[model samples]
Structures are given as C-alpha cells and as structure tokens.
Target: MTIEHAVPADQAADLVRQLYRAFLARDPGDGEVAVHIANMQHDGAMAAVSDIIYSQEALSVRAHAEPARPSLPEGMLAISRADIAEVVAYALEAARHDAPSAYEVELRVDDVGRGTPLAVVLRDALQPPQLPQESVEDDASINRTIEIMYRMALGRMPGPADLENWRGAAGNGGRLSNVVFGIGESAEAKLIRGAFDVVPGIKVQLAFEIVLGRGAAAAEVDHFRRMVDKQGSDISPLVWQLFADEARRRLLPPQHANDPHLAYIFGSRGAVTLADWRTGKKAVAKTAIKHDVLGFESVVRLRPAEDCVVSILTSLYRGGAFIRSFLENMTSQTIFRTHCELIIIDANSPENERAVIEEFCRDFPNIVYKRMDARVGIYEAWNIAAEMAKGRYLTNANVDDIRRNDSFEIQAALLDTLDFVDVAYQDVLYCFEPRLPFEEIAKRDFRSDLPVVSRYNLMEFNSPHNAPMWRAALHRDVGPFNQSLQSAADFEFWLRCRAAGKIFYKVNEAHAAYFVNPDGMSTRPDTRGAVEAYAVSRELYRKIVSPMLVISDEEFLARVDEIDAAPLREGRRYDIVQSALLALGTRREGVVA
Candidate 1:
C-alpha cells in the first residue's frame, strides 16, 4: 500500500482561511482556523475542505452570496438563518437515529467547547419532548410564540392591542402552524409576495380589452386560465404571450381585408388612390372659408374687468347630449367664473343641436355664440373662434368631453404662478360612458418632467393637445391652426410654437375626462387624416425647423423619410412625426440664425 503525506499544519490553516473567504465572503476567526487545521490533519486535507464547504454556516452564506441555481420563482420568500439552522439540526438528528444508512454521519460541533457531539446534544435536548400530561397550557407563553412567529413570517411585530386580540383568539386551541398559515395567506402577505388579486380569467379579459380593443371569447379565457395554472399562478408571462399572439393576429392580411378604411389606407384592394385624395381635397378646398373671410363682426359681448381673461372655445357639431353635459360642467365653474368667458362657434349642426347651444347661451351670462354659414372642419372653426377671442389665454374644449368643475380655475392659477410659461396642461382620464358609472379606459398623466418642455422630446411625443390652456399671444405669433391639415393641425401648431421658443407647463392632476366615442371621426381609421398629418409635418420641417438647423435639405429629407418608413397604426400614424423635429433640434447648435 502507498502512503500519502499529510498537508503541513500552517499550510492547512491558510487553506481553511482561504476557503472561508472564498465561500462565506469572510475570513475565518482564529479559533475556527485552528479547529479546521486540526480537522485537516486528522481527516485529510481534501475531506476537511469539502466538509467546511458543505457545513451549515458555509452553505447558508454561499446560498445568499451567489444567485440561486434552480432559479427561484419571481416572488419567492427568502430563507432565513433560523430556517437553515433548523433544517441542518433536523437532518443531523435524522441521520444519527432514524436513517443512518441513507445519510452520511458527520460529527458537527454542538457547543463552543466542542466537547459534546451534535447527535448526543440533540438526544439530551429532546428526551422529554412530549405534551404535558397535566394539560397546563400558559396563555402568555402561547401569545409570545404567536408574536415571534408573526415577526419571523411577516417581518413585523403585531401592535399591543392587536396582539391582545390575537391572544384572545388563540385561546380556542389554535396551533403555531395555524397562526403561520393564516398570516401567510393574508391580503397583506399577498401584497408582500407581489401577487395580484386579479383572477386569471379577468386578466385574460382585460388583456384582450386593452391590447386587441375587444373582449375575449370563452374558449380564449379558458385557454389562458390553463396557462396561468401551468405557470404556477403567474399571469405576467401568459399576458405577454397573449400580446404576442394578438400582434400576430393584427399582422395578418385577412384581418384588414373586411375593413375598407384600413385596406384603402394600406393600398390593398379597394384602395383610395392618389387621384381620389386630390378630388376630395379639392372639393373641401372649394368651400374653404379663411379665418379673415368668415364675415363674423369682431364684437366683444361681455368683457370682464378681471386681470386674466380665459376664453373657453367650444365648436359644437351634431352631439346635442354631449354639448349639454359640456356646458353644464363649464357653467358650474366656481372660482374662476369671473375671469372666464365661453365662446361657442356652431359649425352648422342640425336644428336640435343648435337649439342646445342657443339655450346654453341664453342661460349663461358671458357666453358668445356664432353660427357659421357652411360646415368647415373643426380646425377652421377653432381658427374662426380664436380670431374673435378677447382673452389673454385661449383653450379649445371638445363638445363631447367632460371637464372638472375646478379645471379652468386650477389651470389659470398654475399659469399665473409660473413665469415664462406660454401654455399650461394637465393629466386627463378617458372613460367610455358619460355618467358617474363610466368605465375608465385609460388615464394619461403628462406630468413626468414639468416646466422644462424640450422641443426635441416634444418632437418624439406630442403633448396632450386638448389639455393645454395656451396664451392667446402664442396663437397670434405662430399663426392660426393650419387649415389644410385635418387631424394633425394641433400637432403642426405645437411644433410652430416650439420653434418660436415657447414653453409649456404641466399641472400634475387629472382635471379632465375625455369621452372615447367609438364612431367618432377622431377614433375611426381615416387615411386622409394620416396622410395630411404627414404632409403638415413635412411642411413644418421645411418652413420652421429647416431654417433653424444646420443640416442640408437632403439630410433633412432623408431623416423625414426614415420616420415615414416606420410602422404606422390607424390612430397612432403620427407617432414618429417627431423624429425630424428631434433631428433639427439636435443640430440647432450649428444653426445659421
């Protein structure tokens, strides 16, 4: 037999210390180093090192120091030191008495002296581990145990009053396990675990409603529920899966085949040709009345003596019920009523809708009503109304939307408080119904970074157009809303104002609610609107942005082409309209001006 020489004591001690630092993230103490050195000499170096690595202290430290191997679930609870020690103690006991053949017997230090083996210590400790024959249970002892368990599980101690109530409840023979389980399954526990109370079925329904803009079928809900269950009650991954599936469905050509609006816009069968657009544009242009030629006499009906004159402009169309609700919300303005005036420019609505506007004008004191001869677009009506506005600030109100009673008051105060702010806007909530029981579809908060409205960032994302109460002078300086652009006139106007070094401020609260009408002109897919917005963006880039930047016309055109090449959605076609604007703003450092 060949004999192998044992490692030197000093070398073994150094190796033990190195192992502690490597595995436990700390150097071993002098006593621990000495103990390992002795073990290394007696049990062989390899065996001693392996034992130290596998020891309870070393394993616990290693488990926390390194990322979990069989990766834990997203919200899994962390294993505590007490839990590790308990498990180690139980395993040692089981190996010594119950299953020595299954688990290897390694003697562990039970005390600081290292005199008693772990197995002997456990045997002595558990000698009389049985319920008392006298049945003399102390309520104080049970309460203390309950409090300790709560602290361990929930990471908080129960209030003194709450602890008394818990102790009273525990009088009915509730075990320690019962208390643990109850607290673990609480709503508070669920919050700590990062688990939502939403059911899998509701999640599937909401996913479809939000993403696909429709409700989920019974079969689809059932399929998603099964997926949620298979993934161990986690619905986020399944929600993402549904989003991918919906994206694929949206990409399919057949989905747009039946919808003539999308087909025409995308140049499919039954497409709206370039000649068709030109014919429509010419027909609208023939009856196009300029703001100056509107023939409405410039008259100031009721000029209030307030310092800040707020002109609330509303262009009424066919929506009678919405117009009434909007007027009611407007007239109910309490604080800023003395400082505000209502201007209604009727765009040839039906007799019934016109009746609603006339009734509102008669009821309200400072309201100015103007009836147009022909039905010009909303932007044209806005321009016509703005020309007649006698206020320092001007805000356009949608007839179908609802505003908070204090919205105008709040916005007016914000504008007065801030210096060099040309426009003030606030967050808005979107709801399906007009009443108190309306289902909120979305809430848009535009207060991420207030006051500092970067033109470059604004080019990327259009600020909430209807939310702002802009200074009337800005409209005069930048010119009225572009009459040629249909849907994106507001977008073009904002870019023009931004080009002239104007700033917009945000009010951090939702002071308005936008009613989402399914059949509304803005909601429905309008290819004409999309194309007009693109054209208007290009026009603004040439007239306003190009002159302000150092880039060549060819470079500017290339940037615009890149933005247009991006994927276009029906409602969000002008999403990338800001790319050219951003490019111009970036190169403005080398501007010729």
Candidate 2:
C-alpha cells in the first residue's frame, strides 16, 4: 500500500468546510455535526469528527481504500454524536494500520467533483479513551458543549433560542426565534439549560443584538422564562419582592397581554403523566397530540417537549378544613412560597368553597381563588387549573387530597433526578380516611412498593395517587381529565402515558399523605362511577397488564373470587383492629378460597 501524503491546505479546508456544510444542512436531531466540530482538536495535525467512529461496519462512509471510494451517505450528515464517535474511531484505526501510515486521501463527492480540492494530512494521532454518552447522562460540561454546537450550526451564539435573549421580545414572543430549536434527541436537556455556547465573539455580538433589539415586555420575559425554566428559579418571598420592586420601579417591561396561551390542558381518565418530568413537561398520549397550531379540548401546546410540564398552575384555589394543615405542611416542607397561586376548583360546596378560597388567597398574597360555574369533574378542574396555571407544573390538589410537607418540593426534586420518571408517588397511604394512626394503615395502601403495573393493573390497582405535581406540557401529549369517566380518568391517562413511556415511579419517601374523602368527586361515584371504573379498568387491564399480572382465566377468576369473598367494605375507614379483622374475616382460607 504505497501511500502518498498531501498538504493540509485548501483541500483540507474545503473538506472541513464541506463536512461542516453537509452537517449543518441535514442537521441531525442532536446537532451531531456541530458537536464533532467542537470536540475535534484544532491545533493538531489533523481534524476529525469527535466521536463519529466505533467500528468499521457502523461507519456510513468507509474510509478504508479497500472499500474503494465509498461515498459517505447523506444520512451520515444527520448522525448522532454518539454514533459519529464510533465512525471516527474506525477511521482512525484504518488510518493507523495502513502500510504507508500517511496517505493522500482524495475527496470524492457526488455533488462536488472529486479533485475539487479537498484533502488532508492523515495525522498519526492516538485516540483518547472514549466514554459512553448515556453513562455521563446530563453532565454539565458536555451539555454546555452541545449547546454551543447547536447554536453554531444555527449561526448564532447565546442563540436567540436562549430564553433570556427574548428579554424584551414582543409580537407573539419571538416565536420565530424560538422554534429554530429542533426536536433533536436530547431535546429535553437542551430546553432545560437554555444557555448556549456561541463562538465567544458571536455570543457577545448576539447579547448586544438582544439588548438593543426591540425590547420585550416585562411580563413577556417572565412568561417566556416561566415557559422553558431555562433561567432556573428561586421561589422565595424574595422572588415576589423582586416582582413588586420591579413593578414599582417601572423597570418591569410590558408583557404581551394578548397572547392567548394562558393554559395547557391534557385530559385523562386515570392519572397525570407529565406531573414529575425531569426536563420539560412529560408527554401524555391519547388525550393530547402534536398539532401545527394550538390544540382544542386541551390547553394550547407550548415547547411542550420541555417547557410546559404542568404542575401547580396557580396556588390560588386551596380550600376546605385542610387549608391550615395544608399551609402548615407546605411551610414545614419549605414549598409554600410567595409565587404560589392556590385556586379552589371544588364546586361541591359553593359557600365553603368560595369563602375558603377567598380567605386563603387574601391571607396569603401568593394564593388566589376561582371557580367553574358547573362542577367540572377532577380532570376538567385539572384542565382549568392547567389553563390557570402560572408556574412550571400544575399539581392536582383534590378537595380531599392531603399534602405532607415537601409534597411539591419533593416531587420537584425527584423529577429533576430521574428523566424517565414522569409521575411519582411517595410512600403514602390512601383511603377514605388518613386520620387513622399511621400504624393502622395497610401496607398495600401505603404503596410500600411503587410497582409499574402493566397498563391493566394501573387502571385497577392505582399506582400514581391522584395527588401529584405535573409538567404543563404533558397536556400536549396526554390531556386534561377525561370527563367521560366519573372515577378512572387519571388511570386512563396514566396508562396511556405509560404506553408511550415509563409509568409510576415510587419516591419511597413520604412527603405527603392522601386521605380519601367520601365527598371527593372521584369517590362520589354514581352508577356512572361504577360503569366507568369497570370499563376503564377493563381497558387498562387488557392493554397494560404485565406478565406478573397476567394469569389464566381460571387463576385470575379464582383470585377475583378471593377478593369478592373477602367482604371488603368498598368505602370505609378504621382505627380499630377488631373492625379490620371482622371486615376482612379470619385470616384463613375464607378470604382466599
């Protein structure tokens, strides 16, 4: 293999330029080409895509002469950074094994003639130890590098897509500026950290461009950041003081008042899916979809991929006897902040509802109150709360759902830790009454093991308790409540979301407790509740039950007999062991056979 070496000049330059152009042109979802550029050592003898090669077979373009001028496939242009690393690795090995060591690697492009000046010195570079991208997870350093490449390919620094760049953006919030972001593989991560790396000079230029560009309204800026959570958050009384101070100083820029994206809605018959997303809002299927424009029946979709995970839209409507306890718990957990807006969506007791909500909001400036004329079911109120939500995620605060301190805070923290986990439940108990001593609660009711039941078990077993903070964007994926069902709307939603992705994630630590209130809408099942629960449970079992839950008809029916014979009172509570034993019967074959 007599190899001929060539100069690292215009040909190398052209090759590099063409590669860059090709990469930017196709623009793979992860901004793969851009990353390769950033990772390559510029000062050295050779330039290469950072981590494009892993093996010869994986390469889209085989560099070895044995393959004789195989043109790199256009697909390679959109390759992921991880795959690219592998491809490049193979190329390096091939370069080393060549008998001549250094070779004149001529460029051959179908679009551009072969010899149009693209060649480079095949440097004898020793490859560095490679690491799997997944192993690193959301490594800060790597993400920042990714941000830079994404911006670089888009031809900007501190890219306009950066939420902060829209400081004073007006006229529908620089929608044009933001969409430039692609639904790339790591889309969620990109949205989480809005900071992008612009070639240093470009970053400075863009910053100045933003400051001088048409200033955005203060409300718009807050709304925009609130949408993506790019700037991070500080939900202290100080944040409110900042708001009030800014308002007073007239430093508050005008917010685009007419933008109608007030709420995001995702409907579900069973559970909330996006409530505990790590990055942007998680997706809930069946009840939501991705549309070119805003959706109907649900809240309008935003950067739904990352920005709109619905949690607590507004902390305004908190009501009932649980108010003091709720606030005290919220306080003890340190989540009761000035930015919260608690609204009372319970329409059952209108007098107590309005009065309690109003008093609570008034007592705490952070809270507010509102109501629907006709009593909307749990899902609908969820929809309403989503629409009314002002923060990152809108949590479902059932009239009877109890909150242990850190319910919101812990959900937030756990969500941040686990990317795959969207809906989370702590080691909390559920039943008509939580007032019973903790020791009296059943282990199963306590959710000791947060199992990922097959779609069927979720509908019947109830994995994610009704009370959870949700990312607003799941509205675009799942949906608000399924008004069609009286009791199982959340189950359907949770099941559907699990179908799309992972389901319930057990936090294993109790931050809140849920007391089943007989008065709770889901519990006040009329005949409709029975029919709806059965129908939904059937569907969930059919669609989502796993191997463990699946049993032959004979065995399954036998188990059902055990449950039916167990004389379990459907909706009752007890602190007395005698009642439990009596109701459950002697701990013998009677309950099972």
Best by TM-score: 1
Per-residue lDDT of model 2, residues 1-593, tens digit only = 00112323433333344343322222233354344344442321122532233223324333333322222322113322222222233344543543211111111121122222122211212223256452322234333433443443332344435533333332233332233333122455455334542222222222222432222222222222221121121111113323333443355454422211111111123321122221112232223212121224423222323332333532223345655545444434334553345644554544454554455566566554555566555566666766776666566665444555445655665555565666766555443343432233332233334455453345435566546655556777876667677566776677667766655666555444555444444433232544465455444433333321222223433554553342432111112223455545655557587
> lDDT winner among the candidates?
1
For candidate 2, the lDDT comes to 0.40
Tens-digit lDDT track of model 1 for 1-593: 00112456665665565456544557779999888777755644434655675677766765465411121111111212221223233333322333221111112212312444323433333343356453444767766655655553455787888577666666676654465567656676667546444444555555555665544443344334433332223344445544655564556564342232221211112343334433443453223211221123522122335553788877777767677677777888754458888888888887567677678767766888888888878888889889888877889888777776667766666566565888887655544455421112122211122233565545444564555788898876889988776677887888788778888877656566655554455555443654555455444443332221222223434555654432321111134346545555656756755
TM-score for each model: 0.41, 0.36
* Distance from true location, Cα of 194 in model 1, Å: 63
Residue 276 in model 1: shift from native, Å? 38
Decoy 2 TM-score against native: 0.36
- Positional deviation of residue 25's Cα in model 2 after best superposition, in angstroms: 74
lDDT of 1: 0.54
